[model samples]
Target: MIVTISDNNKNKTIEIKEKKLISTILSESGFSFSMPCGGKHICGKCKVFAKGNLSEPSLKEQSLLQHESKSDIRFACMTYVLGDTEIKLINKETEILTDGYFSQYDLNPSGINYGFAVDIGTTTVAVYGYDLKEGILMCKDSFLNPQSIYGTDVISRIQSSIDGNSKELQNVISDKIQKSILRLCDEYQININLVDNIVITGNTTMLYLLLNKNVRPLASAPFLIDDFLGRDVTASQCGFTHLNNANIYLPRTMSSFIGSDITCSVLAARDLIDDSKSTLLVDIGTNGEMTLFHNNQMLCCSTAAGPAFEGVGITMGVMAESGAINKVYLENNNIMYTTIKDKKPIGICGSGLVDSLAVFLSLGYIDESGYINIDKGEYITEYNGKHAISISDSGNSITQADVRAAQLAKAAICAGIYSLLNEVSLKPSDVDRLIIAGGFGSYIDVKNAAIIRMIPEELATKSIVVGNAAGAGASMILLSEKCRIENEETAKKAEIVDLSTSPYFMEKFVDCIMF
Candidate 1:
């Protein structure tokens, strides 16, 4: 059988002798397809347009596709290609956050010709290329992490690794990074052999997965790691054979959950970590990692916020991409929305979800307890037997379950912030500045976030969005030896607070659940 896949105006055809899932085919074909639920018939996000000799849709697939308007739409994970088939991927160009704010540092290159700094995020991987000799950044690029085909969040990916797919996860991410590096080199007319240094940063699980280490430790109680990876190895050891001469350095992680990304983010925002004022740094996503610097003391915590903000568990949620509703507001007593790039609305992203909840609360469509009062609003509609508010004319709506998911995510993050503040005997108003880092944080509206209680109202005015500080930190480490040493010191100064054992955190979590 022949399988033809089309993505971004590029086509690739492959031949297979037996039947296979479209997701497997796409992965084998080196296509970046996200199966957030690990092909378990959940998430319902692996939709593709295909026509040819394909197996009949399963009952679950039929139910999942009921709301979709296109008859040709099918879940890539559920569909089987039995014969010649052509699949067209709805691969929207994602608006990745790459820029960030960082303190100035002198250039001190560890290598002579070229270097690359990579920030491997749970949802996305950003790569930055530089001219080491002249201390200039040549180009930067990013793509969806290919390991997402196994799952979305770190916990899910860790579970997948424990289930005997460790090497597979490692190879996919390593290959993707290598491909990104080679592409950057080709685009900038740089020599691959001269790329002498590479610095990579990510969460503990991500770095462990990249190294193909034992993930069983992270899957259970008292999650402790035997190797806190602040070591250097050859690029060939990390599967980057093309850059055989390059030295790859992995930054040290602070804890089992709080990895080097937070370390780098803290390093990037060093100016705020002053003795004069208390500063709170937060990176919100599936996993909420935060650090608080107060009175020469540093405290950090990690909370499982789930993938609701990244559109994994929400009913009509999606990533911040073209056609995704990125903002929502009320104008003249009517709800209004705008999409990224002013494109037609497909679904709501994190920022839009927060805004939607705030708007719903203000309009009385949703009570303080999060119950949907559909009859109170003219745009209210029913979705999957639950009251929902329509966002567009094309059947996109936010269900009651989505609101609860957002509430849970927001509560986790908000409670974490308060717990850290409580430990320092400080209030939200006592903090000097709240530094919000990461792609999702960059686009969220501070007012709406506080309106839904996702962030404290007192700190909303004090929030600063620092885009991809981890990437910036990675770049800093790659360029300056002083930053590399400072990052290690920053990791050592952090005191991890285990939230699971904290009754205070539990109290704040319950209280923050209510908007």
Candidate 2:
């Protein structure tokens, strides 16, 4: 079999004669399948199209094919052949990743100056527009993390770095981000050099890799950095743009995993965090970041919650994009969907996962112990008796395995919150306000989140979503010089919590695993 990834490097191709699992072949071929659920054939995310011999779908794949399988689309995880074949992969569709990755020299007062901000999150990137003169943002946009070439999660990227291919991984991802930035700049008809400053906020590892800094230390151990913050760099140096030379600002980081982005989250929510008697800022993304304020002290931590919540690390998980299922409902005792683009559903992403969990729990599809009754196959009705989870062109069912993946993710995140409460000797009821940051948290239903037990009931009661805090902080830095310094102080004051080494966290995770 000859498998090729479109648009990525061609030199990395491989020839496989043995009939190995699709994931095994892709993994060895230097192409990540991003099937976070260990390829159990339950999650229908590993879609692919073959161009050679034996191109028909397998029985396991026949069910998923009804939703998004054109003559071209096939589930990469299930499709296998006896002879040579050429396989094509699904390209991740992203939007507004960044704005040219450059800074403007001056403002155009009369017309929109079109200054841009980039938020380089571990899981995704968000771009925002602002008027140079008035220094007000026009709109905001976001997309999946272009660095998914390494793997779906930052830890996977770290593993890629550890394999002695760190530089190559960095270059490939950085180039993708740069191209996205250039496209945006060209579309807006603005000179890239005219952008005032390129302010980026990301976790330490992401920021380090973008800067082409050696991140070997971040893989394990004490997990420290050479510096906390940075302020000057040329766009061309980082492969962003050659159009301009701008002072790039990075917020000070509290620890190795927790970077300036958390501080930025605080900055964006300062209006609420500072005024409220007790506040919790939870920035959920690839890394589960949380900060709790009590009396006069601020405590923060980053949890290794994994990427199942955002549609990676699962068999059918995907980032939010066209054809990706975002919402599910119990329609006539069957699962129905609201896809992102009204297209045929290919796979389910984060929001869909949350919604599915809630629906299944309410409908008794999953037991109180989170055990999916695989024996009751009728409860798991197939779309036309096909194996896949969809009932219509773009609708699908949530597999028991998908529910389990969500269970693991929710457990980790909820455990972090529970541990935070334990440390303060308080309960979830003690928190006055809960501010959920990041693109994923912004649009999800707080009540639904509580019902599914993704979030505690008390915290969800007082919760509000603040979209893309990293972008918000970066926008503030582009507009105000003081924000940079304030971020440094914020990082210093935040107390760090290490969940990996905490036994309390393990217990909390176990308790939260049930539906």
- Choose the strongest candidate by TM-score: 1
**Tens-digit lDDT track for model 2 on 32-122?**
3455333557556666666555546767677677766378676665666545666666665632223321122122232234466677776
| lDDT (Cα) of model 1 | 0.90
For all candidates in order, the CA lDDT equals 0.90, 0.68
Segments in model 1 whose C-alpha atoms lie over 4 Å from true places: 392-394
**Lowest summed lDDT over 10 consecutive residues: which window, candidate 2?**
99-108
Residues 62-169, model 1: lDDT tens digits? 898788888789899999999999999987788899998888888997888999999999999999999987878899999999999999999889989989889889
Q: Evaluate model 2: give its TM-score.
A: 0.79
